[model samples]
Target chain A: MGSVFTPRNLLVAGGFILIALGIWSGEAGIVFEKAIRVCLECIGLG
Target chain B: MTRTPKIINRLIIQVAALFAYNPFLHNFLTGELYRGGSKYLCTPGLNCYSCPAAAASCPVGSLQAVLSGRNTITSTYVVGFLLLYGALFGRFICGYLCPFGLYQEALYRIPGRKLIPSRKVQMLGLLRYPIFFLLVVGAPLLVVDTFGNGTAGFCAWICPAGTLEAGIPLMLTQQSLRSLAGILFQWKLFVLILLSALSVVLYRPFCRFLCPLGLIYGWFNRISLHQIKIDSSRCTTCGACVSSCKLQISIHTNPGSSECIRCGDCARACPHGAISIGFDIPTSQARTVTRN
Candidate 1:
């Protein structure tokens, strides 16, 4: 079995940390704000 | 005749795509777009945030939005979500969850002469990296409006998935949107139509050539926890798997190639049962097996 501290595993752990930080820092809320409103430019209407 | 394992997998994945978009059942009945808190989360596939039934944000769209926004705070939410998915499943999401990918497969199933991509066509898969770099990241970061806000270049200019999933539905349902339709909408519609028609003959043309998300996830396929493994001890170089692969990959040599979506078609096609899809095995084992 591969060690738990393998580089890949570490990267995965880092990914989780990043996600947590993003949420805690309200970055997720920013994404939600953008996502809730339909950006007409995104669908190419503008 | 019984359905093949590949068919079963596709069916399960199609249902997953449906559930991913319609997580909030109420949105289906109301036909009103979900604007709930769950929209903050990003799905593992190419679902459009603008999709009326979508319960989550699109990672690609969110990444572009963040890059374009003038906000000094650089959030890693999109990157983290994408990295997490890529590191775990890689292109498996493309094969098993993306609604657009399922759409392409459904179109290919139609009664028509399927276009077998040539070696040159397969090489075109490399083009997606540049697209990811330029359209998804670079353009959004570099090109700014008069107010210094960047544009969501890929979503605004290139994403056919967004056009199909969001634009058409919104247009059909909202009378007010009809008056706002202009040249940009027409251009997107034209692109969507062209891609839809192309999908009937080509196997996942967008995934193969255009999807930036695919390009990003594919980079991790070689190291992803869930991956396709080839056991050379049971293998014959019969070339059966290659013919079976829609992505035109050589399974024995490069099972984890970025173009591979982990659809398991190659594994199912292998008469020798040499190819296996599983979790928690390092790709080094596959290399060792092939060398022996």
Candidate 2:
């Protein structure tokens, strides 16, 4: 069996840390702000 | 005749994922995009955020928006979301979850002479890397307006999913928006139509040749928690898996190929039951499997 410290597990850990950082740093709110408004550009209007 | 277990399972997941991404059915009728809390969260698949019924944000759209924003603070949420998903499931998102992926498959299922792409044509798959870098990352970060904010160039200029899921629907419902259809809309419509036509003759032409999201997820196929294992002890190299795969990859030689969408087709096709898909510690024999 492979060790617990496999690259997959390490990357997974890194992902969680970044997610935590994003949530704490208000990045989720930024994403929410963009998502709530309908950008004409996104729909190919602009 | 009953559908194979892989097909049945994939269909179930894809359907469930579709509903999960766009649960607000009433919005479709109202011709208004969903503005719910779920919009804060990104869907694993390439569902459009502006899609009338979409309840969640699209990762690519979100990524571009974040990149183009004037704010100096780089957002980690989208990156983390993608990384976590990639590490956990890889291109399984493309095979079994993406609404756009499902759309391509449905298009392919239409009655027609399915065409296998030539190896030279298959080289088009390399376009996704440049697309991901230039359109998704570079353009949004580099090209800014007078206000110092850049545009989501990929969504604005390309992205047939947005055009199909949001543009056409919105235009149909809102009479005012119909007047806004110009060169860009025309170009997008043309792309959507052309791809739709190609999809009838070719299996998942978009997923195979385009789709930056698939490009991202594919990078993690070698190390994802979920894996496809070929048990050497039970194996006869009869080439069943490769023949069964629509992606046309040699699974026995390289089970962790980036081209593999993890649809579990190969596992079902293995007559000897040598192939399996799940989370497990790699054994001594399985370690010999090569990565692409």
Candidate 3:
């Protein structure tokens, strides 16, 4: 359907593409690494 | 005499929030915080990672940390998770899941002169977008130290939720942290106190005016798989839904508004039962089907 290609659909497609790219690049490990430490600055102590 | 569905939903989410932070029960009993491996996965709602009882990472904080890291190329995980959430549930997490949202709603239940948001207050809601762009995304990408590391601008400067949920509790629990308290800590504490007081009078002031995570999810509300829908054939624009909506959405005119958290309050309040929530096909496709 012609209406299926609306801007909202495009945005959702873009989101899916970004997710694929993230998995391809191995960013999960980086997220895991950052999660382990309590960043003092995050809670404003630093 | 009977409890409303909204009250039941609120109680269910309150229990969920309690369970989300329940991993460190033993730590609380022994006067210690759990620092564990489970913190790696981001929770669906805005629970602060720094909370002593938190077992999962915060998506917004993780996004900032990844973007501000020396190598920015590896932020796919955080972005992917955020995108997945946005596309699926939008602000449903904000209305029913976020710990801070529950806290604010609980404060609002206190007997007081409730301030219905004025036009000016509604206009202030637009500020969340720029806050998202500048502090959450822009500053992290643009401003970097000599080592090419960025700062979590929103977390470091403005997150009252973080200050309330994590900073205050941590300081009260850890004696060493109290000695290290400085002007920045005081500033954040002041913000926390002010927001807490305001939430008693106004509904979800932080979510309406300052939450970047809400802004991010709002962009997808119109297109998210799970959404609030209104059947026009069954509808009369009697203004009941508008009054029922805590977020001040005009559901008859724009059912899937960005401000709507898919909370189903409007549906519950509707006299004709015109509104519903479900994982339906996109609105445009549904419109095309109607036209044919």
Candidate 4:
């Protein structure tokens, strides 16, 4: 097996780190709130 | 010699992802969107959250929402999720998972005069970058109203997937929604109709030219963990792979080009057994072909 320090693995690690920060910052709750409510704009009402 | 198994596997995954992304079957009957816990997460594909049966949110929609709303935390999360998906699978998500992609392919299969993309047609693909930057990112972040709030410009204005999957279906089911139909809805209908007509001749016109999510995923195709690999030593340069590609990509010349959706058509077409798709480490190739 090659080293885990490949460019691809590094990007994946960065993604995970960002996700953790976002979650800790309560971003998931915000996504949940926005998602649960249907945006009429999306239905072309706007 | 039959590519049936590979085709069937991809088909199965496409159908399964379609249903799995929209599993709240009862919501379809009620004309209500699913407000489940899963809504917090975004689907890897372009399934609209407004679709009554959608179990999760659309990543593009979520990103736009967070951007327009100026919610940095949510923006971080949405970008991270998309990055993870892009890094892991690239546009394999488009080839084997997206409901919209499947729908377009089915439309293309309708017997008719097929149009192979010309050079000018291929040039039009450059439009997606502007669309991604302006509609998906810039407009959402910069265009604000009196309330100092921005809109999800792409979803509101251009997304044919939302129009087909959510708007039209919701309008058909709910009388109130139908009554609310205005010029915008009519315009969306026109866009959807035009795109559907075009899809009959040209393959995946939206993914090639308009889909911001597809563009984002394509950026990672060159470096994604799962990718298409070509063994130059095994290749006979038969050109079967190029002909088989509906997207008009040359896999042997550029094994993991950003334009490639990793659909495995090239691999299946390679009579020499030169091309393969998966996690290939310690990259090995005998020669690189130069196009003239």
Q: What TM-score does structure 2 among the candidates reach?
A: 0.92
> lDDT tens digits, residues B136-170, model 4?
88887788877767878899889998998889878
Worst 10 residues of 2 chain B by lDDT: B283-292
Clash list (residue pairs), candidate 2:
none
The DockQ figures for the candidates are 0.71, 0.75, 0.48, 0.78
Candidate 3 i-RMS: 2.8
Give lDDT tens digits, candidate 2, residues B1-292: 1113467878899999999888887887778877778888988899888888998899999888888888843668889989999998898899888988888889888987888888899999999988888888988888899998887878887798999889888888888889878998998888889888998889888888878999999999988977887779877999999898888899898989999998888888888988888664456336545431
lDDT of 1 at B272: 87
Clashing pairs in 1: none
Worst 10 residues of 3 chain B by lDDT: B1-10
> How close is every model to the real structure, measured as TM-score?
0.91, 0.92, 0.87, 0.93
Q: Report the Cα RMSD per candidate.
A: 4.1, 4.3, 4.3, 4.5
**lDDT of the structure predicted as candidate 1:** 0.81
lDDT of each structure? 0.81, 0.84, 0.76, 0.84
The docking category that best describes candidate 1 is: medium
Instruction: Please give, as one word, the docking class of candidate 4.
Output: medium
lDDT of 1 by residue, B94-193 (tens): 8888888888888888887989887887788788877888878887788888887887778888899889878887787777887799999999888888
Instruction: Report the CAPRI category for model 2.
Output: medium
